[model samples]
Target: MTTFDKYPTVIVSENEKDVWEGSKHIVKQLKTVALDHNLIAIECYPGIDVKKLYHDVIQPLNADETIYAADLFYNNHTITEMIESNLTEDDVFGTFSPHSLEEFLDDKKVKAVKEKLKSNQKKNIIIYGMGASLFSNESLLIYVDIARWEIQQRLQRGMPNWRTNNQDEQISRKMKRSYFFEWPLADRLKKALLNQVDFWIDGNDIENLKLISKEKYLQGLSQVVSQPFRLVPFFAPGVWGGEWMREKFDLDKDEVNFAWSFNGVPAENSIHLQYGDCKIEIPANNVVFYYPTELLGNKVYGRFGREFPIRFNFLDTIKGQNLSLQVHPTTEYAHEEFGAHYTQDESYYILHAEEDAIVYLGLKENIENEEMIKELEEAEVGNKDFDDEKFINRMRIKKHDHYSIPGGTIHSQGKNSVVLEISSTPNIYTFKLWDWGRVDLDGKPRPIHLHHGLESIQWTRDENWVKEHLSSPNQLIAEGEGWYEEKTGLHELEFIETRRHWFSTIVYHETHDSVNVLNLVEGEEAIVESINGEFEPFVVHYAETFIIPEHIKEYSIRPHGPSEGKTIATIKAFVRV
Candidate 1:
């Protein structure tokens, strides 16, 4: 009737190297398994990649096994209850060796006969684990094959068309996702477990986890921690799947992240731990949307990719495709004209391109009121009838072609070209001023929003914008040691910047004061660093969000194994003034 009763507990050491070796022995001993070993209750270790562990050790041994990363479920509840409900004060204890779960189900263990078993027989041992699903190569091959096809199918037929079938192959997927794998809902993970959805370790060195921290304490905290981060939510048309996002986490708009309950259970998060504690709450809009919304329209994947909150989408048009010449009202204009607005300022930081890739920035360069009105009428009709005309002036674009679209600038990605549009969250409030007859897959022409488009259009076209948008981005002494540094003198000190951030096996140092919003335009690194001494690595992707807070500079980021001789491109945006 105490914290340690009812089960034969095996507390492994909190060391990776020790755990890896201990694992070889546990797999061999578990063969004499009984019913209470039924739960095979497992623990996750820090920096341990569970998937790889099973691949090398468990599958070949052919034993039932389970694995969990303390990080992902650090905010999960069912996992906590699953662990706590099984614990009591009278349970017998053992290390990573020959232990018996028989004590829990009321069975007694026979005394040892003082004979030692061979540890290095090299026999094929049976391995069992919760993470077994991802460990076996056979299972991964099947999952990956199906996933690739799924992406292909959605791309070719379009998601909308796929949704109209009662006999859709994804119906089983729906049944499955209905219970587990849900975002914005705690029960999602619960359902996943109920559905027997097995997850494995997703990194290297995971082979050494069970031997590390036997700290069942963090597992206890995993249930109560506030897993806060911003997101935007939505669903793709024709598909029942929805996406969620929390992009604009205004200091004014949010209080608590969109709260969720899991597996028919209430959140175990203490009311006091809501938003104030953990000195490192990533920028969340007081909402717990599982991911970002699907707004990146026109063949581009939308927002839900980043684990971090803020991400920048860069679009560069190569050919002369009239960029559905749409305009966006400024934050102020958005409210007055459309009745709703958020922090939506987008810029076109253009690079090299052909001359004909005329990016129709705003209205034509230098024209009259009559001309503006006349162009609008013609542009609208063209979009209706699919006519390509010279309604907007063409910028003779060349190499290093650039433009800054601060909200109201009407721009589009032309065909056969390239561009980098550094913009705010892709919340589509684009007032389409013009598009020359674009049709959907249904053979129907897309509707053009003349009224909204015109309201947000930047009427005046200054001929010298190319000069204004272009800046010689340079580097200054970056604030922190080991931090990437490059200073520049462009727009009144802090306008726009393209920075180079690298994983310095050579220069990877530490910093504290300044925060860098890195847009990984170049390479990738597992940015595992500590905010207040807690360590976890959120991946830095090609097109994803990753933030290093101002205070948590005492952290280290090492490349994920193959990260030896690689370089990456990053566009850093922050207030220098």
Candidate 2:
């Protein structure tokens, strides 16, 4: 059995009341670990109000609480000023700062924390805040983790009224007030302390945990380096969200509708590690930081460093509105203009398509630049419908059709379709040229980037050209007793390759120093096994995404049920050499 299947991981409800009850359950686990230690410290990000949580755990035990704020140890003015000066639109991913958690952990503060443990006055202490564990022992370290989406949701739900004045200021203050800009620095600090973290607790919905001995924690990290793993998918609502994901995934019905399901966007997604009755939630990016070569392979690691280089997400526009017509910057333009390392060269792999489902791609033939610009500008401000058919090429799609979208290609996923957006990791650089004259759910005009989109658009990729080249074709590569493999898209700038496999019997494959991401597109379930015993075999469900690290060189796939004489289809993507 796999680690998760063998272990009895704690399951908690997302209900507000049950979540707190779950926290109390976590306190019970912590009590056991705290018995041997003189001091217990919890490390977490800023803006976490653990006052009641601390009281719940420590008050029950009658242990005296010693609180130390990481902010208090910071050069407040210097850091604040640094963020304000460097913060820009380009800081969408993150901004680097000379002021890091290491520097903030002043020698005096570290010494003070160390001296307190040495004394006999208070036998038990709780040091809680960002980077607190950096000053303590590994066994004594308890990490309380929170999701970035949760932080933003909480801020919007219950912020002081005065904090929401100016639009730009409100956005900036949210990052500044919560110290989100310090994430890159915080990640650096966490990288150094990951090996030392003994207990990891989730502070998002309910208090879930992965409490393991130091040896087990380290062993788990090593196993992660050579496994076919999957991260917990992240869900979010958008203006044009639909009900497909909500009903399909059995997600909470109270939240509006589901717009996106982040299946493997390491930059913003997280993974959960199960150890018996406990589980630890960590950022997927941390997986890369710890095992760069193993996870990304040699060539990918050399080119992108610790960045996971690729992203896979679901776009649910079924029964919803169309996405804004957008274009991504060229690689050179992205680096020169935004300090971004890569550009978004994406594709739309149609997962489900309803009758008349359309995808807006490229531009119509003989389209006049001046007229198109004038029409888009008018649509941006006034209540007028630009003749989309005269400019944009709307193509009807069916299930499993792949449309390649290199950089500078204008595109949008139309309504009544569920699209799997496979692309490079640079996700936020889309320049929206048009929005179909529709306002956002907030009743505000969505932001437009006419100037940027105009500059990024490739006029050469017109309707006819897109039909001939961008519409991907499948080519049979190999066949076995009960299986066949078809190579799909391979674009130069896209830097990723895709293929489809039809199999009933086992099909053996190897990563060959390149990481692979796969999903069962047309099957109930399948089993993925490592032939060389590099990692445990795992079951993948329909439309569920999973990763195979480069270290797991030899693997095989076999359908779960007896052969019904029907071939199951799977889609696989990997970084191109």
Candidate 3:
């Protein structure tokens, strides 16, 4: 049995001294803060239930007046008109919005709310909602934050987008609106207001809320970058799901199957901070937003700003089905169509595979692009079963095989294999060409994007080019006592580089002024320690992904506990210099 930890937490403190739990305790803290400040503004992320918040915290506090930021926003129709370009008619894809949160507000209603706040100066006033903090900076600012994964779950449960009534809307459409329109605007505002926030609330769990002071929150973030840590991994089921994770990770047996595990994608994962016995969960992206320089290094921060450019995730097809035939938009196409600065250049590192497992890669030699596109279009409409083997290259794969897939190169992972997908963070730009005539778990036909795929596919990258440039060959780079390192590529066209290390004793590593993500691919247990005693020793098990911040210049890893004195291996990914 694999001892894979699903909920990994960073130990910020040994005792719980500054954390508050439950609504009653949270309300008591707010009541005390309200005594000194005239306005207590509780700014919320979208998908938060502000009405339930009013009943639990504001109503119990007995404030003189409560102002909801939702009331001051323009009507739903007006908001739709303002963001129509961003929320395109497409069900899956939308352009990123350039507008700010203030653009969505009604100036007249905002002015009126300001007048009301001034008139009630003598009384205790509370303002709470999405844009509550826009009224004043001097108010006691409390930010209620929920992770993107949590918001996605709420969307699946029929939660409407902010200030929009779409409870009956398809989940994909709702997610598109949030991703392109609401989330970008909200994240910009959140980053701008992060330093000004006085308190932070973990609103992921409605019944049980966790509150931490700004001092404690910053302290936790600072402690995180100083050491090797793991984010809380989230699992989801898909139409082509698998049982590897369900059985190995001891997941819920009732779940149909686990298809994907977001292990190192900070944007979609949460970080758990342990203070004594209390554990508070916050979005992992908060670390990227606040400590971009410390966490991402000067060079990476200069290039990507606050975005965590690289992603590490799992795509499980073991005992399930093949993924859709897909191609990611090229750099120029992604920028022109989706407002993305970069495209998804990815690589698949096979973690586990059955004997007959295969991977569908670039097109076959001398295949006609027009003919392939015509067949795909016809197959999409249920006219005939698409002959995949005729045009696409199929390669037999086994454990530890790696394949590089740059944008515009078609690819798919066949059934009975578990793939560790490392790529750029622009994950939603995949233009799926075909789905083998399979419907989604909802029994609805999956959406196909043959038009975009045709425009983006690189016809030149056929079998010859794929075999020559995409298949990774292990090239030994360095060797020391009891250790040897090999370059286990991400192709030269990709910005990320990968290295595999096999060691029986200690292996030294430096960050090279860039953040590094690693997984123990061939080890039962290992320990990572700071070379200069900068941080404590961190233990990891097989198949667990962990991050080493850019500032940790020097560290060492070796087999530990039961695996000590035994050869073990790890695969590490970092930005290319």
Among all candidates shown, the one with the greatest TM-score: 3
TM-score-sorted candidate list, best first? 3, 2, 1
Estimate, for each residue in 1-577, the C-alpha lDDT of model 3 and write its tens digit.
7689988999999977778999999998888877899888999999887778888877998888888889999999999998898888899999999999888888899888888887888888888989988985688999999999999999999889998899999998999998998889899999999899999998999888888999999999998888999999999999999999898889899998999999999999999999998889999999999999888899999988999988999999989999999999888999999999999999999999999999999999998878888899899889998899899999999999989999999999999999999898988988899999999999999999988999999999999999999997788999999999998888887889899999999999978778999999997999999999999999999889999999988899999998998999999988886
Tens-digit lDDT string for candidate 2 (1-577): 1111211111322222212125556667677768887677778754344554466554565567575655446465555555554454532323335456665455776777677667843467767777667657633787666665566566666532111222344443455444335556666777777777776556664434323344554555566776788867777888878778877777777988789988877667766655543455556776788888989899899989888987888999888888898899888777766567788998988989999899988999998988998898888777577778889988999999999999898899998999988888877678888888877766767778777788888988899989887887887989989999987775666888888899988888767568888877887778889897766677776778888888777799888753335678888888887
List, residue by residue over 1-577, the lDDT tens digit for candidate 1: 1111111111222323212123565344333332222323232211122355556544544534332312222223433233332221112110111111221111111111101112312322222322222222212110000111222233333221111222343332332221122211222222233223222221212333222111222221231222211121111221110111111111112422211110000111111111111111111311111211211111111222322222343342322243566766666665564333243455543433554555555444555656666666775676334222334544555533334566665665554343445444424456665556555334555456666566666565444553455233444556343346554322332233344445434344343223334444444443444545554444443433334443344444444434545644345553221
TM agreement with the true structure for every prediction: 0.42, 0.84, 0.99
Give each model's whole-structure lDDT. Answer: 0.34, 0.71, 0.91
Local distance difference test, candidate 1: 0.34
Question: What is candidate 1's TM-score against the reference?
Answer: 0.42
Where model 1 places Cα greater than 4 Å from the true spot, the runs are: 1-311, 314-322, 341-343, 349-358, 382-403, 418-421, 469-517, 524-533, 537-563, 574-577
Q: In model 1, where is the ten-residue run with the lowest total lDDT? A: 261-270
Clashes of each: 81, 2, 0
Query: Can you tell me which runs of candidate 3 are displaced by over 4 Å?
Result: none
Top lDDT hit? 3
Ranking by lDDT: 3, 2, 1
RMSD vs true structure, all candidates = 19.4, 5.4, 0.9
